[model samples]
Every structure is written in C-alpha cells, then in structure tokens.
Target: MADKEMRAVYAETLTELASKDDRIVVLEADLMRATGTGPFKEKYPDRAVNVGVAEANMLSIAGGMSTEGYIPFAATFGCFATRRAFDQFFLSCAYAGLNVKLVGTDPGVSAAFNGGTHMPFEDLGLVRMVPGIDIVEPSDPVSLKALVQQIAARPNSAYIRLHRKALSPLYPETATFEVGKAKVLRSGTGVTLAALGGLMVHNAVTAAELLAADGISAEVIDVLSLKPLDAETILASARKTGLVISIENHQAHNGLGSAVAELFAEAADRPARLVRMGIQDQFGEVGTEAWLLEKFGLRAEDIAAAVKKALKG
Candidate 1:
C-alpha cells in the first residue's frame, strides 16, 4: 500500500476531473485548504469558487449552477453540510434532482481536536433520509478516489462524507470500489463483521486475529455505500455466519448498524444475532481522536468484544 490519505486522494481526483471537464465547478465554503482542495484551486483557479464560511448560501449557489448544466462539487465541514444547509440540500438539490456533489469533511470521530461541535455523528442518517440523494463514506484513499470518479461520471445529487485527517493505507491499490456494493474482504463461516468508513479495515484486521486465536473463523465485509446499501452481500454473509456485528464511527442508530439490521431482519429466514458497536446516544466532548474512540467503544478490542458477544449468543 502506498502512502495515501483520504483528503489527498480527493484533491488529486477533483483536480483530474477538472482537467477534463470544463463544466465541473468546485464551490468550497472557506475550506479549500482544510478539505484538500488547495491543489485543485491552484490548478483550476477559474473553475473553483471559494465562497467564504456561508454553507447555506454555497448550497443554494451550487444548486443553481447545477440546474444550469454545470456539475458542482460543494465542499465544507460535515456539521455545516447536514445541519446548517440541510434544507438547501433537501429542497434545492435533492428534491429537484440537481447534479450536485456535497462533500462533508471531518465526519464522526475524525473531527478530533475540533470537538463535538464539529463532529457529525448523524450526517449519514440525516442525508440518507433525503429523497433522491446518495450517501457515501469511502473507507480509504483508494476507495475515495474511485468514489470521486464514480460520482463525477454519474451526475446525481450525492453526499460524500470524508475524514478531517488521513487514515492509514489498508487496502490494495488494485482494490475495485463500486457504488451501492459491499466488498467481502475476508471469508468465514462462524461470524460476520460488517463495517463502514475507515473503521472497516480496523475491524477486519482485529476480527481476523481474534478468530485465529479462538479457532472460530469470521468473515469481514466493507459497506462502502451507506444508502442504497449492498443488501445482497449482507444477507449472504448473515445466512452463512448466523451471527453479525456492525462496526462504525457514527451512532448505533440510523447508520451502518441500523441499515444492516433492517436488511437482515427482512431477508434472512433465520436472522443472525446482531450487535451494533459505536457511539451510544450521546454527544462527544473535546478530546483526542484516540481517546474519543476508546471512550465510545470504537477500538479494535471493542469490535472484537462485540463479535465475541454475538458468538456467545
């Protein structure tokens, strides 16, 4: 794996897309540097619009541009994207089916030093409810690049959540990422662990080690796209394992856990015992990312424990 970060990949992909498409305009809410759009702005200064600090106005402007045959990529923090400009996204962009790509940076615990005010634990759930809007959270740089290119090619209203900082490279460069599809990273028959975002790689690695120690094999699946989930893969894993645990950095409800539970409950004849591991129904506080993850039971050990609990039941 090469040294690639989610933000760096986003910058590279957006820059590449801007090179070929003249109608692809970028609107950043004073976060060009923070969201890794500095390179794109430097290269395509004329195409990128830096609308300072006004996320609601940015969404409206982007929606207007999208209506006029211009593909607009709006970048801002997750809090502003979902909370501040939600109505704009719902009515102006999604409701009208405008070709707008809403990029939300510093989602979930990735906000780190930005504290609870900046962290967006409910962004995915919030965005998923919007009609005709796609929700996505790429697991790593490779997947992030693939997602950017995918969204660019398929002109639809979408919300792509990103981490404030880079995560460690975990997947191979050759790994293929498809929208509305889940990738099976590892296979087993005892228990299944489905994870989303950067936590996928961590949960998979920990499950592998735990299974090896206990001599109980565990399967790992990465739910790349949150909305329009890959229900086929999830049902298949549940049928095979009979025990499922969903890991995420967001809250337990209306996120990856809730999505998987709904699918398994409907499809699986003998529904697997499912456990959701994430931040409970509570707000985050000012702390380091590591401390916050541990406090909310998002560590690899916590994932392993959840899987063990599922197995016991």
Candidate 2:
C-alpha cells in the first residue's frame, strides 16, 4: 500500500528546487492549502503568490513572470486549470514561447467528493491541442517529484496532470526517468496494458496479475508522458503482445487511448488490436474514488474482464 500524498511530494520538490534555483516561483489560484504547498509558502513567502481563485489571471501572471526568467509553476483544480485558464496558458505562455509549468491537481475521478463541476476528465486532451506544449502525468510520488524537476529544467511550456491524494509508491527513490519516455512495469507475451496517471497504471498492474492466474501474460506500461507518446516503447509492446489496451483516468477520446490508436494507425506495419478503456461519455458525479471506479467500469476487474473478452474474440 502507498502512504505518500502526491501534493506533499510536489510541494517538497518545488521547495527543494527553489533552494538551488532562485528563479523558481510557485503560483496558485487560492489553492495552496488544497494542493498542499503550505511548507513551500512558509519557507519562501516572496516566491509564492496566491491569485485568489482567479485561475486565468494566475496563468497570465505566470506567463508574464516567465518573461523575467522566473520558472513559474501555476496550479489549480484540473477543471479550471485547463478549461478556464487555457487561453492564457496557450497564448501568454506557450504561444509566446515562455517557460511555465502548469499543474492541474486531482485529475479525472480523483476529484471524488468534489463532484462533476470540479473534476477534469479532459484536461490532458485540452492541453494536447496546444502546439509545442508538453503533456505529462506522474504515476506516483517518485515520478511526480522527478517529472516536476524535469519539466522545470525544460524550455517548453508543459501541463502536468497530478493526482493530489495518496498513491502507493511504484518506483524506488533511485529510479530514473526521461521526460518523453514510457516505463515498462511488467513484461509479458499475451497482451499489453499501457496506462497513464497513478490510478490507471496501478489498476493495469493488478489486472496483469489477475491475467497471470488464467495463464495469460499481460505487459504493463506506465505512460508518463502524454504529448510525446513514447511511440517506440508502446509500439514495441504492441508488437510483442499483438493487443494493446490503453487505460486512463480521463475521457476515452484524445487521451491515452487516442494516443495509442494514433501510434498503431500510423505505424508502417501495425502489429496490434487496440481497446480504449475509460470514461466513455458522461460527466463525473459525486462519489468516492472506489465507487466512481466501479461506476465508470475502471476497476481492475473491469480491465481484466475487458482483456479476457478481447482475447476470446
């Protein structure tokens, strides 16, 4: 079981980075408390700015600050961070070629009790539409910490879909990661499960174990980077298994599923059949993460059954 809260790790990473790089700034839309940045603010008051629920203005502020060579990490709920402040992010930051790291917390069903209005099932897809912007989702505390540093070190504007709650540690402290690469968690010969974010990636691993009992091998790939897609890693798994199921906590369209589909669609010799598993077409409702997982058929059993059904066909 995992014990670390992602938000704590995020805050710690930013604070540590700020210690070495004085140019680092943390911007929040009145969500510093919710997103767990209190420690950072306490340690570096001058570098922490709260825009008071104005997400759009937050990004715009971040955009302007980036021009002064400050590396801004603007954060808010996923819904507002991407949908409401998208124009400022796309135009003021990405279009202007300024470096800003936009963080969207509690992505997808992770919003839980916050309900539909605050939830974001399309944040990554929305950011995907912005040209030259990098999109990433970290699967655990380790990845979150690493990717935050990696994105900060890069020049391109980036969107980070973060799961703010507790997630089990999947990678060791010494684990290394590349910005635009996929991590293969399990190797198998039967089917491939390529997943993004903390929730889906863990479920995919469990589903792989369940498949093992039935004499079926399932490979699991943690899709850390969404925009770059890590085509080679995914395509290699597809070729090895001949079937690829993309699992995510977001909408089925234009998220992990669509990314994988595009890979097979454009491959010189496509080697796999693809199935996209996620929220099909509906708004999220108020429910616990476990209940919402079953409601949306995103549970580990659901993934295992989906694989069994596909194999039977």
Candidate 3:
C-alpha cells in the first residue's frame, strides 16, 4: 500500500474525469492550492472557476452551473464549506436537486495549525441536515479517487470531507468503492469497530490488531459513505459481534457515532451495544495531527481501551 495525499489524488482523478467528460467543472473558493485542485485548474483552465473566499457564493455558482447540465465540484476549507455556506448548500443545491459536488479539505484535526476556525468538527452534522444530500469521507487515496469519480458521474448534491495532506494507503491501487457502501476491512465475532474518514480508519485497524492480541476478535468497518449509510453491512456486523464501537475524528454527536446509533436504534430485532470514541463535544485547537489525536483521545490505543471497556460493561 503506497502512501499519498488524498487531495492530490482527488485533483488528479478529477482532471482525468474532466478530460473524458466535458460537463465536469471545478469550482474553488480561493483555496485551490490548499485543497489540491490546482492540478485540475491547470489542466482544464476553462473548466475551473475560483470564486474568491466566498464559500456561499461558490456553492450558489455551482448550483447555477449544475442547472446548465455541468457537474461542478466546489472546493474550500471544511469549516468554510459547510458552516459558511449552509444556505447555498441547502437551498441552491440540495433543495433544488442540483448536481453539485462539495469538496471540504482539512476536515477535523487535519486543519492542524489552522486552529479552530479552520478546523471543522461539525461539518458532517451540518451537512447531514440538508435533505437529499450525499455525504462521504474517503479513508485513503484509492477511495478518494473512486468516490470523486462516483460523485462526478452522479446527479445529486454531495459533500466529500477529506484531508489535504498525505495519508497512509488503506487499500490497493485497484481498490474500487461505491457511494453508499461500507467496506469491512477485518472480520471478528466479539465486537465491531466502525470508523469513518481520515485517520480514524487507520486507528480502527490498529485497534483491531491490538484487540486480537488480547484474544478479542473485532470487526473493522470503513464507513466512507456517510449519508445513506450501508446499513446492511453495519447491521450484519453488529448482529454477529453483538457489540459495536464507533470511532471518528469529528464530534461524536452527529457524525459516525450518531449515524451508527441511528441505524442500531431502528433495529429493534438486532440491537447491539454501541460505544462512541471521538471528540468529547469540544472544539478543535492548534496542534499537530498527532498531538490533537492524543488530546482528543482518538489514538489507536484509546480505541483499544474503549473496546475493552465496552466488552466488560
């Protein structure tokens, strides 16, 4: 598995897709370099549009572009993409059923030194509220490229949260993915570890290995498709394991934890005990990714401990 930046893969993949599909267009809110869409802009200069720092305007413009039968991808910082452009996202894109793809970079702790204002801890929560919108957080470069292609080929509003920097590859180069599915990386019968986006998937895999050393079999599920989540996979794992733990970089309230809880809550016949591991209702702060993961109790060891505790109680 090679390590590569997801943003760079996203740009390269989008550029490739645009070459074949003339309707594909890229839009940025003056953050092409930060979001790694510069390659797409450079390759297809006429197909790229930078709308300054106005995220709302960028989304609105994407909605208008979608009406013209163009698939537009609007990119910006996660915080600005969702928090600053809720109106445009909900009304202009989702409500109107426009084919727009919203790319949010540096989600959660990936913002690093950008501090709380730039880090988005609740972007998923905000986007989840918009009716008829697809939400995705790719776990690796392969998944990012695959998901970007999927979003571009579809005709619905979608929000894709991803890190701008390089990430450890979670899948092979030929690994393909779908928009509303969860990939089970590891299988177990004791407990199920469900993780979404960023480093959390990597942590969950590590935690599963640690749990195995302790004679605890844990299933690991990479939840790339956030909206219209793969309930079949989640439910099957929960039923087999009888216990579940969700890990994510976002707040535990309305992110992966909440999504899994909602799925389990409705499953009266196959209910499983679920414990969540994530930011404890706190805001992000300035720090390196490693420091922030420790500060927020999102380390692989922390997830292993949570699984141990969940098994006992």
- Top of the candidates by lDDT: 2
lDDT order, best first, reads 2, 3, 1
Over the stretch 1-313, how does candidate 3's per-residue lDDT look in tens digits? 5788777898898889988999999998888888778878788899999988789999999999999999998988889889999899889999998988998888899898988888899999999988888899999888888888887877789999977788888888888899999999998999999999969999999999999999999999999999989999999999999998988889999988998888988886856888988888998999998999999999899999998887887
Clashing pairs in 1: none
- In the range 187-256, model 2's lDDT, one tens digit per residue, is 9999999999999999999999999999999999999999888998999999999999999999999888
Q: What is the C-alpha lDDT of each candidate?
A: 0.83, 0.93, 0.89
The lowest-lDDT stretch of 10 consecutive residues in candidate 2 is 1-10
C-alpha TM-scores of all predictions: 0.96, 0.99, 0.98
The candidate with the higher lDDT, 2 or 3, is: 2
Residue 12 C-alpha lDDT in model 1: 86
Model 2, residue 115: distance off in Å is 0.6
Off by over 4 Å in 1: none
Pick the TM-score winner: 2
Q: Candidate 3: which stretches are off by over 4 Å?
A: none
* RMSD of every prediction: 1.4, 1.0, 1.0
Clashes of 1: 0
Ranking by TM-score: 2, 3, 1
